[model samples]
Target: MTRVLNFLRRPFVLDLRALALLRIATAAVVLTDLAIRSTDLEAHYANMGILPLHVLYERNWNAYQVSLHNISGLWQIQALLFLVAAGFATMLLLGYKTRLATVVSWLLLVSLQNRNPIIGQGGDDLLRMLLFWGIFLPWGRMYSTDAGRTEPKPAAYSYFSAATVAYVVQLALVYWCTALLKNAPEWTTEGTAIYYALSLDQVLMPGGRILYQFPEVMRFLTFATYYTELLLPFVLFIPVGVPFWRMLFVVVMYGFHLGISLTLFVGLFFLINMASVLGLLPTPVMDWIDRQVRTRTQRLQPHLTRLSNWRSPVRVNVESSLNLPPKTIQILHGLRNAVVTLLLAYVCWWNLDSIANPSLTMSEPLRWFGYLFRTDQHWGMFAPAVFKDDGWYILDATTPKGRHIDLNRKGRPLTLAKPASVVSLFKNDRWRKYSENYLFVSNAYLRPYYCNYLLRVWNEDSDNAPVRRLDVIYMKEVSLPNYKVATPSREVLCSCETAPPAK
Candidate 1:
């Protein structure tokens, strides 16, 4: 027990400048989201369909107008929230009043999430949540607006560390639940999970039929994806053998996300998964990043060398004399070595299911698989499926309602007439690689939003058809350069092969 306490109290050290840089980078990314959304505020307001504050108030029989949606009155309040979030984000970047700033930053984030649940989308919310927690930690001890405020503030520091741990735990729980659910026989045996996904609208497709046609390749992909997820636990614990395995797993997972973006019209979901995985990037990768950054700074130093030297000799001497040795840095000294050690262990064990099964369902040990199969949701989104007396079957709805209805039966020509909005946004040259690459393989690769979209498209089509045979052929191609989001050609030709061979 004494040893454990000593370990928790162990001091850890890190470069203050690096933490500051990371803070700025993360803050800039968050700010960019605000900028993008703010520009489209009017359009978003009309389209987002948020639950109005007044509506809630009226429903609850409140007297005063509690609405936050009015253009005249609420606009300023909304702007203030954005400003506060932006201000705290800047303070976080500058390392100023980190403890207070972290709490305020999170409040701003929550306000935004609540304001327009749909428009302000992406894993940025989750990242902000985690960063908010980090803000309370000893993060500001180094590269912060408070970089010089290194005096011991035990209460503040304790709060920050606790927040950070809470964020970590939230991330672990998310991955664990997702991995636990993805295991299933259908995903393993036929690769049906991805096959149904491939026929979605063009935005979600990487390159149309070209990707899905390679049957053998798809099969291998199916196996590899599930297997890697299942083994996450084992790999996380093998300290001696872990480094290589973890690296490989990270690469594979990233590649899978990249594929989803390319093929599907999905990108945000990929970022969310990537954010959680950031916790797994071992210290070495971070060290390498730091080294590269330092080298670049060194290269630029020559330009400012003369100016630096022009400083008074006394100023230089005083600063040099006051510099603290690495061992003497109190923050590093105070880090409980046990906390770091236990944190790593918890990370490995908590999300073990992610390593064991990457999908949102379970497959092996048939006994437990049934429980997973019974669940309908996967990480806040449902799968693209239909109800049957036996079980649920997945379907594609991006094809025309007329033709998609026919394809439900097995072994049909799997062709579709030009869809009105089948083409993917990612497939366009404007976003190009940044868009389609993630959308294409998103479902198989674990891109959350895209997967949700897939599920929605499927479930929406449930009332439409019974299967026979469906083949769609387009009479004319669709082309319209002026429109940002162009739809596919509507001229569809469909036929049923499962019907009796016409005498």
Candidate 2:
């Protein structure tokens, strides 16, 4: 029993340095995500944008959802929250007030995601789960301003606790659950999922254009992709040759997401996915990385020492304020352990329920906790099946002079011809995601907002022709088997008029 327990624990032991890297990478992603979303502050967040506060509350919001961003309609307020989130992210990146910084950062992220979920994708879910698990992990112990004094660095530089177990298990569920959700014939029998995915011209990257030419290669890759997601996650739990497995797992994921980035227009998804596995970098790899950066490390020591000194007084003040008796601290730790355990159980159940597990199901009331913390997730990227519909958007509009134009092309001459690259029609992945969501029958209400926004933005420019009418046209093309292509269909998704010259 003793040997079995020890063996079971090995998979959960994580390198402190790797966790530190995770902290820095996660914080960087948060800041980078903020920067990307900031570019569309008014258009994506404010009342003036495609989704106003009222519309979000009425249509897109969950009952348990909470968003500070939802409290105001002004973009200025949104900007202030963005700045606050950025500041906390920087604190997390530096490991200054590390736990507090992480908590605030997670809260802000959940709030931001709640504000505009339409632009969100699977990567957002992973990032949120990372921060959630991060709250319970001592990831700031090394390569951080909080380092050196928290606890003596273990000889192996490895830490194992309930939190680590939760982290490791959580990472596994991301891929395993995603694979389980992919139950369609495209993934298993037909082996044409990759072909269908690449058929999406709106998301096809430069690499995909060349790769899709080989049908046999695509079929082979589809099986590899499916099995890779399904089986590789199990390797993380293998105790034998643990470090080798961990290293292999990390490398495979790095390559996997790298391949996805090269072939698809998934903004920040690949980067975020790659960052998710950083904590699995084994001790030997970390040691080599440290050796490579030894000189640079030496140069930064002085500054780090100064930072530690600068934070000492703040630390002291905090310790004095909440300095509970030893008994109280012990009880608090026990309570924390209980909470983490419950959360872990809930998350596992949530994933199981998501895939409609035959024997297990979670009660709806229990999901309130997940929604409140934004821990509820669905990793179904192209699951159940790959999307068969692949298309591009055309913002067809008629000018006041009765001349026609395409707002998607900055009011260029209206033509049915597809652009050189359908993927280029989207300004960014957020727009791409929103456009994808816009095609759904349930999201019909979102169409007019996009239509109105496009018309307004296009008409704002003095040089632009004033439009009498505009139509959101989707040139829909379905991916066909045997490398056969479907004829593009012009679907008028939404139509808007420019208020008939202000009545």
Candidate 3:
């Protein structure tokens, strides 16, 4: 029992520099995500957009799920919430009130994700989970404003805590679950998953097209991806080889994500995943970094001293008045530990249940708990099988003046040749996800909503010709082992007449 406790506590005995790096990386990701979402503020968050609050609630909401975005029907309120989230992200980056900032950022992210679940992918879930775990960490112990205010100097390493165990396990489960869920033969014997993925024009970037020409290389990568995810996570448990294995995992996984980013436009998925791996960087690396920083500071101290001598130093004193008794502090600490343990245990149970049965339904109370906290997780990325049908969308619109125009290009007919790259059509990951959702037959409702929204956007533009009618069309290419001459299928999803502009 003692050995088990010691083993579990090992991950929590982390270098402060590692935690500081994690803080910076996570904050950067949050800022980048908010900036991207801001570009399509009204289109994604408002009632006038593709997914209004009512529609979102009707389709995805349960008794327990809560969203600040759902509280208001107005776009301004949602925008304000987004701004506040950005502010929290900034605070987190600066390491000022880090725990509070982390909690607020996570809450806002959950609100935004629940507001329109359609626009989110695996990356959003990872980001939320990271922030959730971050709240319990001593991330502000070093390289932070809080650290500067302490009377006695803070330690260079953080004390062991249960939250550290949870963090490491959470990351391990991500890879393990993804690998287990990839039950398709292509991931094992056939090794054609990357081949099909690269062939999909919608998710593919320019580099993917160039890589698609080399079938053998794609096959090698497909096998590598599978084995890497399957085997690397288990390395976390090898106590004797922890450092070497962790360093290997970090390098290989970082490269894996880099390759994915180069070949596909997965929004912040790669970036967030990469950032999360920074937490696993071995202590030696962190120590080396600290040493280098110290050396640099020593080298610059003389110059800094001369510059400081030019101005009179101002001294300020700060004091803490509120103090809790030892007994009360012990009780509070126990309560916090109990709460964290329970949450971690529940999350573990959910992960196991999901792995055993992807379709398993939890009890109502458990389900409600997950919904309330937005802790529901699913890491199946291209599992079972990678999507073989890749396509682009073509919006055919009829003007109020009885003229037909392709909304993909202004003043162009619907018969124009498909663009070489469809990536330019989307502003960010949210738009990309929205387009991907439309490819599925079950998400048919998205067609009419998006068509109406597009028409409204066009009609609202006084500088452009007004559109009265719209059709949502999908042009798809089927992927096969060998390149063959095939005709693209054009399928019309839904048609709708534009509603008149609001007075």
Pick by TM-score: which candidate is best? Answer: 2
| Clash totals in order | 71, 0, 0
- lDDT: worst 10-residue window of model 3: 310-319
Any idea what lDDT model 1 has?
0.43
Ranking by TM-score: 2, 3, 1
Measured against the true structure, the TM-scores of the candidates, in listed sequence, are 0.53, 0.94, 0.90
Query: Local distance difference test, per candidate?
Result: 0.43, 0.86, 0.79
lDDT of 2 by residue, 364-473 (tens): 77889989988899989899898888878888898777888888887789888878899888878998999999999999989888889888877888888788788999
Residue 294 displacement in candidate 3 (angstroms): 5.1
How many clashes in candidate 1?
71
Cα misplacement distance, residue 170 of candidate 3 (Å): 0.5
Q: Which of the numbered candidates is closest to the native, going by highest lDDT?
A: 2
Q: Write the per-residue lDDT of candidate 3 for residues 283-316, one digit (tens) a residue.
A: 7897787677666677676654422211111111
RMSD of each: 14.6, 2.7, 4.3
The lDDT of model 3 is 0.79
